[model samples]
Target: MNASLESTMRVKSSTEKDFLKLSGVNAVDVGYKYVDGKRTDEICIRVHVTKKKKTVYKKEMIPAEIDGIKTDVLEGTYVPQMLSPKAIDELLSDTVKYRPLKGGISIGPDRSVGGNIFTGTLGCMVTDVATGKPLMLSNYHVMCIDNGWHVGDQMNQPSLIDMGTHADGAGTLLRAVLSSHVDGAVASINSGINSSAAIVDIGNVAGTATALLGDAVRKRGRTTLLTYGFVDGLNGTVNIDYGDGIGVKTLTSQILIRPDTTINPRFSNSGDSGSTIVNGDDKVIGLLFAGSSSAPFLTIANPIGFVETELAVFIEAGLQPNLSKGGLENE
Candidate 1:
């Protein structure tokens, strides 16, 4: 290995465990060192931060360099734990059962706690590159229960949150990746179920687009459905609370969403966790996952490119129909 790579590996192996245990620090990773905005072959430490002020001032904190490798710090707000609940009457209604299984619809793991329902949005439909199988896309927390799940676990549309019970199994969890960089998962769609590439209220997706700062975007979510927003920041690092026992997890390389306040102040809510972010032209940009608890709530998402690469799937465009399903159109 190169000297810098060797040094980075050694430093991370020696200090990663201790750094993660520190308060206000959210996550840690290894990457190429950058100087004056230019990439370098040197290895470096990248730290995710929630409470920047507190972390920078902590006594006996990790130094700027360890074993001659530089360190970089990224700061972002922490997300709070909250649930979005639907009306009990709606959950009992038959309309939800009849709704098409498509992007931006409700979905969740087939598990419950003391009768409480958990639900999130289905981001989109992607095809496995290796097998060419259709799969449902969503956040790891939304579909895999933040790593508290197993392959073959049933996935329900309308989620238990919307009253989808075990009897209403919609799909099966195929894979999941819950790391500091992403929170994404996929599931095999049940046979005979109609899955679409169209978003609930946003119509058909054109294609995948890169997220640029200040770009206009929109999303159709289970809660706060069909909201518009702008890409406020990129490569953000934030601390996200995944509830009790799971505690807080740090996310890096995140895309930030700020709602179009002049129109509607909220970009997303709890149940909107798995909604896909799209540009005005309906091109995929990112996968929605978490947001702040208070006003001017900022939304966080994983970049679309990262998600596609990590999941080994492609978020199909509306024009491309599933050839295997008799030309079934994508929603």
Candidate 2:
């Protein structure tokens, strides 16, 4: 992340040279412009900055005010990468650095999304399955409002909670890698990411397998990074309520670990929607999403197969090519 780039926007001269001078900025461009009766307080600036560089893939982002909100975007062929929990935390702490950065990855607003920087508890991964293209994924509702691409002046990424910063005391910092733009349809699928993802075994249970009651498991969340718990139940369901009169009810659950009131192993509160939930063996068993408060409550996670299936469909459709070549060739 180099240094945190703060500020969602700044009034800059319409020249590329002027925008580059903004703190945390890498570059700038204009996506569109409109002055309406409702846009009295809006700010607009098209800026670009380098986010990732792999021998196979390199990318940049531009800042634009979407509906009066200052934000970065991935247009045409760009991808969104992720920052590790430590990196994100450090940047968030340095308001000056974060504000001037001039760009950020967009999380989606699928029903599965809990929250983001506004509420913190979100660190994400967006990846291409074919050649293993990379991205930092999150609930988009926080990144863009209804995916309309609104432009405006703001303090930070929409709805991002920064749970690490808001935490009361010492807490674990999660790690995540950001790097690419995911297919817009990834969130539209009911089954979650499809089989396009490599079935890497980090712990137990193995891809989509249900865990026995009391099995120890851990998961890596974009916001909280990694946390552990025990499988509490099977074939369970929870009715989770969210803002906008939206929520997931009778939502399926593959794990029900013993409540961790003492140490809060679950990674997200409300904002870490869609994070991966794995067993002790490191096999992602479910998607760690809606919880009571980014920490407690009987968390509801979607089946791993669901996510894989969605990703697979996007891959087969040739949405985004995995520039990394599935790690077959190192940069």
Candidate 3:
């Protein structure tokens, strides 16, 4: 059901205090828009906790705001603290939060989070433009992360959404699951759009996650969630300006995300490229394709609009990705 987007289903008629009591769960029921302008029921999966954790570092509740809406922001500065369901409750104040995978409370006993962690947008959709076919895109890479992104590899993406009580927005919800791979999940999700990818030159990637210049976007990575920022003009386009000492190739994006919007912990980290990128109102905006980890390490994203058409074409082709052998997909 709508479990990936933990916000899709929440305790009904919840108050700030109610959400404050938030802790992770396996499954629950939360409704979205109703038929007669009433509340309807929907399935929601609580953020899962892993068991590999050995200790809890830091766990403290902090007060913060959600898009001008006052709320509490809980922090887990250490490994074990990251997966605290109660802590997650405080952070997900009517919003989705991607907890770290290392936290044992969220992992399946049979599964492992070591090789690479996993976290994806859980409330968005993709479609083909030409044939109007529908697909759910994440990233070709997420399917198989052995050395290069491949087809037939398993991955995760958002399906249902509940935007929650916002000004001039509707709450949405859906259900979905993640396997090793999907045939055409990329084309289906991207719908031939590149809104969520960016430039990648090494460490197992090609092309860039696409995004629009000056577009508002959110990234759900393995180590963090809701990392908000905007797209800039640091692309591969070649241009020579005889005006001054303006040399190109200096890919740059110093765009600042509102501190309130930034995920205290980045949802995804080094091995989290195919993670979902969303926009306001909980729509798929882009995918977290690339970034750096140095002083002022800038991040880069891909624009979905660029390849939306191409994705549409693939969606029409009807490729069913199966991660049969995509180079040890975290096995």
Candidate 4:
């Protein structure tokens, strides 16, 4: 780490807890400061607030600078990136069922709430470390839903919420990791179902890489399809609402992404959770899990290295798309 990052990390380590206790503050991290919507060269501590207020109590007021380092307050409400029932219906017609499952498509557990099934995107394909079998990767909230969901629960493509029925079964939940650093899970693909290492429009992942500030990134997701962004922050901690059973949780050491204005204004949206974030070289970098739907549209993802270590699975990549069993054809 450089001097600026090191200094910011030290300040964050010493003051993060106090900042989190303040009302309206939801996350804290180190990143380049922005002025008038343009990023500056200076590194500062970023504070993500659910909403910004014109006036606040003295106790809630965030300082302009702390420990000689600047601070920034961003407004956004972070939640687990899953589609609501109404949103699922609107997107139903477009959710295609891929024969040989690949990365970056609709998928979810067989569970439901108020008769509407849950839905999220599949992140990628991986090899089970213990069994060496092909398994589909996605968020724990998408595959397992809650702590009550057991191993072997069924998963579906296009998700059951997106007009996919039980007949569209694609895999079974094999493992999940809802840790401080990762919100990932893997499912065992059904025997007849084929899977490819290729992401929907991004082609095959070359390998895994570490994301650095200002690095260009891209992802294909269930809701947004293909979009580009930039790594704007790192080693961050954010609070996310994972619904009733899981409730509010804090995730640490996350990779933060901001929209790439040249391509699309928005990055990941709801139902885009579990999308794999890749660097410009097509190397996987992070597993997208949460984000704000509003301005700046900051997306939060778990570093792929942390996810792999937490879930004990290796993301399979670098091979050409397989052509057997009516699976994906390489472009």
Local distance difference test, candidate 4: 0.86
- lDDT string for model 3 (170-201, tens) is 11111121211111124222122222122111
lDDT of 2 by residue, 1-331 (tens): 0111112222232234443444334333222222431212222343333332233222323334433545432111111112223345443321111111111111322112233223222222334465453333333333332333232212132223332221111111111211121111222111122212321122112334545444566654434444566654343323223334333222432334434444564434433444555565545565554443222244545455554554442111222222332222111
Native-to-model Cα distance after best TM-score fit, residue 52 in candidate 2, in Å: 50
Top TM-score hit: 4
- Let me know the TM-score candidate 1 reaches against the reference structure: 0.72
Question: Which regions of candidate 3 fall more than 4 Å away from where they truly are?
Answer: 1-123, 129-133, 146-216, 236-268, 276-285, 313-331
Local distance difference test, each candidate: 0.72, 0.33, 0.28, 0.86
Q: TM-score of model 4 relative to the true fold?
A: 0.95
Candidate 4: lDDT of 83? 82
Q: Rank the candidates by TM-score, best first.
A: 4, 1, 2, 3
lDDT of 2 at 302: 49
The estimated TM-scores of all candidates read 0.72, 0.39, 0.34, 0.95
After TM-score superposition, what is the CA distance of residue 248 in candidate 1 from its true location, in Å?
A: 2.4
* Span of ten consecutive residues with least summed lDDT in model 1: 86-95
Q: Candidate 1 regions off by >4 Å?
A: 1-77, 80-95, 113-115, 320-331
On a 0 to 100 scale, what is the lDDT of residue 263 in model 2? 59
Question: Candidate 3: minimum summed lDDT over ten consecutive residues — where?
Answer: 100-109
